[model samples]
Target: MSTGVSTSTDKIIVDKSRGHRNKAVSKAVRQTRERLQSGHASSSAFDRDVLQMYVTAVLQGAAIMPLFVIIVAALGTYFAEDASLLFWALLTLTCHTANILLARHARTKEITAEAARRWRNLLLAGQFLIGCCWAVFALQDCAACEPSSFTLYKGATLLIALSVTTMSNFMLTPAVLVGFAPAVVALAARSGLSRDILELSLAGVFTVTVVFFNYISDRLFQFSLKILSFQSEKDDLIAELEVAKSMSDEARRRAEEANLAKSRFLASMSHELRTPLNAILGFSEVMSAEVMGPLANPTYKEYAGDIHRSGQHLLDLINEILDLSRIEAGKYELSEEAVSLLDITEDCIGMVQLRARAKNITIHDQVERQLPAIWADEKSMRQVVLNLLSNAVKFTPQGGEINVKVGWTAGGGQYISIRDNGPGIPEDEIPVVLSAFGQGSIAIKSAEQGTGLGLPIVQAILAKHDGQFILKSRLREGTEVIAILPAKRVLQSIPAVEQARPVAKKRRSFA
Candidate 1:
């Protein structure tokens, strides 16, 4: 039973090892495919950035190496001879100066892929030479040196050199390996020449450390590649957004120009169009009334009346279109006045009462008495009331009730509300009703099709007065439209009778 248990454990371990090996092979294959595909693309920018980072690292090492060399030279027991110490110092200084100059030159050069490759080679060569100079210390015989001192000196120098190169070149895996391989080889060779068990063991440990650092360098390289790729994608997205914004601005500008042209055309032709329309309406009315002479046939009179009505309707439509165009073009100028809301509402009610009576629709009005006058354009205010009442009468069913109310608002403003019980607009079609030349689905199916500019004109006029217009409706229920004049537009004043009775009230005694 114990043998069988051991066999099962061995099988599990073997399976795990095989799984790891397969995973590694798969990863290597995917990486190779990616490299082959990416090789065709231009990597100039990536190369430039990598080269810049490399130059920076090289410059930093040049600054730090001279200090390290000085410290090592001061601590070494064999370097008491002035000539030998000076030779070592000069060699180290020369290598450092050459590397500094090379780094500076590389930094100033425009980096292409070829240029980056050349710089990498030059950098690795400089590192190799610097490593050789340090290795000479390991090769030097210190006759007065204790075994402990010699070991300490060699280990410290090699470890410090390894740390510096590893940190500097870790961004590029191949560069790191090439730059530090010489130093690793030198240390291992020196250890073997010493023929000491402890030294050989230390050398093996150093080689293993170098391999571990190389692994870390490869990981850092992959991380940097991912970061760079992400940055590239971010830059592309920003460019696309900028392009979209520019296109939107251009489209908006073109639309404004086209709208301006249309407004100008309408303004220019208004007189020409209205003159013909006025003549047609005038002549048709005269013929229908038989003012000049009796018509030859009764049917001719009826046709003439029809012509007059059609002409009048056309003129009203043209006027509405012109008004909407002016408002959109920012050309509508308000003729300001103090207009009584009650009086305007009454006039509008009287104007539309005939149409409501034709449909047998009862018009109910609830207006607050002595409502304050509003500062507004009188003609515009009249148009606003007429449009609302017209829409209510048009949409209200036969024998249905229409409610018109004018009163003070909760915010100390004046408002007019017109409601009708009819085939009310659907909620989704409300926006359509509000837009110019847009009608609800029900309106489209009705026998009376409107020009659809009435509500938009009313909205525009109210907006010009710094007021708000609200329309609320639910399908098959009812529609309510409200026009509100802002509080600032409400005039503060006393009526003539009230002002005249002030002296009489002052003379009266308190009851």
Candidate 2:
């Protein structure tokens, strides 16, 4: 009932804070994405410092290995009189110089992606160049060697390593695998040993295995991140749905309370109205009979008759209102008993026949010859039939036919159809016909005054009995109302004989 409000100062502060938060989050997200896409830039302190340290360590390690080999080879040349000591010494010196220059260059600044890729490629090219130069010198010593093919194959392996490493720095394993494996094989084949082919095949298999492992690891890491993201989103959506469900439940509870309050208010109003109405009718009847004095003229008597009739009508309306309130409160309970459908139908027709006769309308009863016993409260069934029949009589035109038919159907159900040759309901208004205080479009336009609670009561009663009420109509073709009731109570599992025996014994004792 109350409108929500926000003070101007609070609104301004909230708006400003929200805008600032949105801008900050957007900027941070963009920067993080950009950094992930691009490689490290120059002058980044962390990158320069770490790369420099790593490059220094790598050069130191590279020199130690080559230095050990050079010293060992020199000793071998001196002791065993080997002829290629000069070539071996020059090769070691060249590798040391290249490592020193690379280390110094790395220390100067951070390595950008482009610079890293370029230098990596150049280093691979140098490895191939040095291997080829050594192989060429070996070929000259052994004339049977085809040194050019081996050199070309080694160059291809180096190119593959460079390409793979550029694609991903994490591809280090694959890069090292492809780079060295083929070169080792080429070296073996050039040596002209009989087992060299087997060694080359093993190296090829080893390289493929390394690449396979790297691919599987990369895929696994990606899949893990994706699964975590999916679960987080699912949890957030479930939380939102739970909040919506709680809000809906609260709204439903409030609606039910409002409906109960309305029913209670109507019941109280009806009670208050009926009290004064009874006194008015009672005093009018006394005056009409001249308990105090006789009417002065015949016209006065006619006026009194109108007042009595109107009073009765108002009483009927009040009773209908009270009955509807009881139905809404679920205070109208059915007391099951055996009653014949034929009897009820005939009785209802007899009650409303005079009203039909007043309008020259014929009330017809076509009850089935062998109607089954229905389980219901006899008084309530009487009310249901009377209300329907009376309503039919009120709406029937002169010479119009009112039909009441009863029959036993299959599935152990009894049906009573009440039909009348009256203006039928509009098709679109059919759904609202049973709703409380709602009427058909045609009914609204007509002069007939009704509380509009009759069908709602009928529906509620039928629902209590676990039965059904159906309406079918067409414009200018009359309307049919069907009430279906089960032949038996479908009582709980307690035996009927056990229930009857107690009543029979009591009757015998009384007798």
Candidate 3:
């Protein structure tokens, strides 16, 4: 199997089972939530909410309806001749009382979707009984008054009742219809049999009024339904957000634990691994130098030199890994002091100068005069500079050029820039190279491969000092890495105040 040069840290897991069990579970949860919000015929949450609104409205208006009927009956005793009007008012009040008790009881019960139907029917039945009382009220002729006047009186009372019911019970469409439709039909039937033209006209007008208000009531019902739907949708969205938050928290906890475990393992094994590495380096160096005596076989001497170089390379890789792990674990503390960027850069260049000379690479150093010392970790800064310079020397082709610069930043800070005219990193692969152990295609194919920790270490060190790290590169153009220390980190030296020595004359004047 041939592996690709570029790599990613993501992991993909595939699970194939009978119905994709995980998806099935999620789908079930979604469908159940939707059903609870939308179901109407059954006792769903929507039905229960609407029913609760209806019950509450009826209970609130319970006393008003009785007060109205008693006042109208008292007025009838003076205006009309019918003694039966008092009895009708009493009966209507009784029906109102029954409905109020029923509504109050329903309000106290837990009405779910399953029981919403039963509760609604009971409420509608109570309302239909009230409509029967209104039907009886429509029959009173008020024989003591003029025929036309009585007709107007009857029509006006019915209109008021229709308006009241439509307002109080509009949430339930059936309640409105059963509460008032019987009275409209009764008045129409009574006026037709009497064959009175004036009475018939008033009755027709009353019917139209009832129809118009019912239409308005329907619009109210739709609007209320829309409001309820919006409310249900809001509740579901809040639930989903809560679930997502919990899942995110869980995943974060797991990631932190795994990272902690990795740090512990690396820390514990560091000493054990380095001890053997030191022994290997010592033995290989002794053999390569032949310090005890000269080797008889030339092939043996060549092998010893290879062993020494390989051991040194392994030691370097081990050190880089441990440094990166410590940085990630937040255990790498900065021993901060005032350090000069020019001095550090110059020293790093010297350290890599022999390697660059072996490859015929020219390094040009540019320094801004009078650069300020920055408060930062000295050892970490040296590591950052050396890693960048080493990379430049390793990648720059024979006789290529590298430019190094140290200068004051525009924001009264300091920066170190290292640029190499080698095979530049592909723009898309810059992130890959910056990640831990993430080598780009160029690095993977290079003759001198690296552990891919150089830039990451440099970035981490700069971050510890509250500085910035920027890497810019293009395909075959060049690569430049800038490490910037903020203005706050630049230790600006204070000018000492110059003052002449105070003369002793003040003491003589006091004496």
Candidate 4:
């Protein structure tokens, strides 16, 4: 117990010493939780990761982008018979291909948080270059077709291109605006030059549509960021929980090892301690009794008697420590047999009777007769009875009453209960008193004190027998302790077998 206690204490001290590490982990977790709760989960630290995803997305749809550009140009050239549309298509394809090459190169390179802004600026620049190609396309006049129809066709082409850019490049925050805003501005400018009302209205509607798509793109990016943040938080929580579990397991294992070492040390040293102790007791007893010769001085005999009593006390303490250690170490093996619970309780009462008489304490015992013997260790039962009786005697005031009971339990088990009208323990200190080497306020104030292993040993012994030990106490009222044996341990009387006499004569007469 000492070694285990020390080890736990040391671990606590070490944990305190390294509390900074725990605080840092807690801080990160706290910040993450705050961000989520405050609806600010889109951390700037994840920008690099988002950019990486954006680069991959743009490169994936690279072939399709150039195809759309060529198709739009070809459609316009068919309707308008314009060579300018062809040149515009060629220029757009070149710009779109360059953008693909840039994104692919960025993907191959290591993208770090520090380099994220640089890469982002570079990609936005490429988008603006492609937007320039769209601006040039917006200006191509359709001379071979009706003016209104060509305007419609041109408007449709620009809208389609803007829609495609928005839906695909929404992962990047400014991509939709950078790639299409230039074209929208060019259309507005062309409408202003024409000085027509419908053209101005069309230009205004195009600007509004562009703004709406950009807003939608930003919202989608936010939604994706929120989902990623949640995933990252979950992963961190699980990892921390695993680490905590591992630390707990390690601490438990180390504590067990320390307890084992303590038990082993105590077991090995018990004999080394008791051998000299035995000689001291023997010699002191002889001197106190004056077996060989009478003592010259009364004080000398008194000193010898004191020595004997002190040695006995030391022996008792050692025995209690060893018993508790064995029980805690799971090494206490019970010697089982049929023992009369009633008989054992009576004997222990008698043993403590003289001490009760010394204090003028009256003991009232109630015994239920016709009780069967129970399957238990006789020595353990005796020890259990004695410990309860001894505790009753120690706490009982002079002229106080002690009640000892042996009876059948409600569940058909055997129970021995000892109650004393003494200064009872406080409700809070009951647990403390029940622990090893713990004492209550009453015990601390009294002349009588013990190693405090008595109740614990009794509890452990009952547990081994598959029984139960209960202590009930109230402040300034009284205390009662009950030790119960389960019904399985109750040995019932076996009925005798009746023998058949002269059975052969009856069998001969039977059909």
RMSD of each: 19.0, 13.2, 6.3, 5.1
Q: Per-residue lDDT for 397-425 in model 2, tens only?
A: 78999998887657667888899988887
Ranking by TM-score: 3, 4, 1, 2
* Per-residue lDDT of model 3, residues 1-511, tens digit only: 2222122321211112223543554665576477556643222446888899999888878888898898878877778967788999999999999989999999899997799989989998999999999999888877679988877877788888888889999888767678887888888899889989977887788888878888888889888887887776676667766656655665566577578556655765676677888888898788879998889998888998888888889889889999999988898999989989889999899999999999999999989979878888899999999988888888788999999999988989899999998888998898898888888888779747778888899889999889999999887877898999999999888999999898876555554
Per-residue lDDT of model 1, residues 225-300, tens digit only: 6677667656555655555555566556557656755665676567768889999999999999999999999999
- Whole-model lDDT for model 3 versus the true structure? 0.83
What TM-score does each of the candidates earn?
0.77, 0.55, 0.87, 0.85
Best by lDDT: 4
lDDT of 3 at 419: 98
**lDDT, candidate 1, at 434:** 97
Q: Distance (Å) between predicted and true CA of 502, model 4?
A: 15
Runs of candidate 3 with Cα error greater than 4 angstroms are: 1-45, 108-110, 498-500, 503-511
Candidate topping TM-score: 3
Question: On a 0 to 1 TM-score scale, where does candidate 4 land against the true structure?
Answer: 0.85
lDDT of 2 at 463: 80
lDDT for model 2: 0.61
lDDT (Cα, tens digit) per residue for candidate 4, span 1-511:
2423466654553454544655666666666456446643454868888888899889778888788888887788877777788898889999988998999999999988889889989999999999999888877787788878877777788788888888778888888888887888888899999986766776788889889999999999888898877787676667667656656776676678578667757865787778888999999999999998999999999999999999888988899899999898888999999889999988998999999999999999899989999999999889889988999999999999999999999999999999999989999999998999999877988846678999999999999999999999998898999999999999889999988676555446656
